[model samples]
Structure formats: C-alpha cells, structure tokens
Target: MCKRVTCPNDGKPTWWGCGAHIETALAGVATADRCDCPHVPVEGNPRMFEVKKTEDQATA
Candidate 1:
C-alpha cells in the first residue's frame, strides 16, 4: 500500500502561499495522516468530496 499524500492547501513550506490552506492541511494531516509529509491521501482517502446538489446549479 502507498502512503497518504499532503494537502495542496499547505503553505508552511514549498512555494509558501495560502496560510489558511496550510492550517487546514495541517489539521487534516494530524487526523487522517493525509498530509504529504507523512501520508498520501490518494492512497486510501476519498477521491471526491460531498457537496449539496441544487436544481438551479445544474445547467444544460
């Protein structure tokens, strides 16, 4: 099995951007170890997230 990856939101290192994103990434990493430094999210994490569907949101 592969290790979970890090979050793109991370700003602590690398290019150095989006502090809020980094914070969220840090927290996610702590819980599911889905962060890049330790785990690779693609390994065992959900590929997609849940979002509310709207009738008007859909377009032809």
Candidate 2:
C-alpha cells in the first residue's frame, strides 16, 4: 500500500493510495512516478492530525 495518497475526489485521506482517485490525481501531476501522486503529501491522514513531515519529506 502506498501510504501517501487519498481520495482526491472526496478529499478523504487514506494510508494507501485510493485506486480510484490515485489515477485521477496522477494524471494531474506531471512528475508523478508510477502510482505516485505529487498532490498527495507523503503524510498520511491529517484530518485533525498534524505532522511536520511525511515519509518523502523525511527522505528529502
């Protein structure tokens, strides 16, 4: 599971990329790799949850 994407269509967050919305978001991000969606912050859930960095951000 890709813990860096969500249902962009509904704005609902997910630990794994939502198969339905991922493709949608992926099309929008020019730099997205494979199923990676650039719009998807490396941080997972954040509804009332706040984290300074996501997995990708940490790597960077």
Predicted model with the maximum lDDT: 2
The digit string of per-residue lDDT tens for model 1 on 1-60 reads 222332344422221222224454344445444323332223233542222223443241
Identify the leading candidate in terms of TM-score: 2
Q: Each candidate's lDDT (Cα)?
A: 0.32, 0.39
Across residues 2-58, which tens digit of lDDT does each residue of candidate 2 receive? 344453433334334433443454454444333222343335543222223446554
User: TM-score, each model?
Assistant: 0.19, 0.20
Task: List pairs with backbone clashes in candidate 2.
Answer: none
Number of colliding residue pairs in model 2? 0
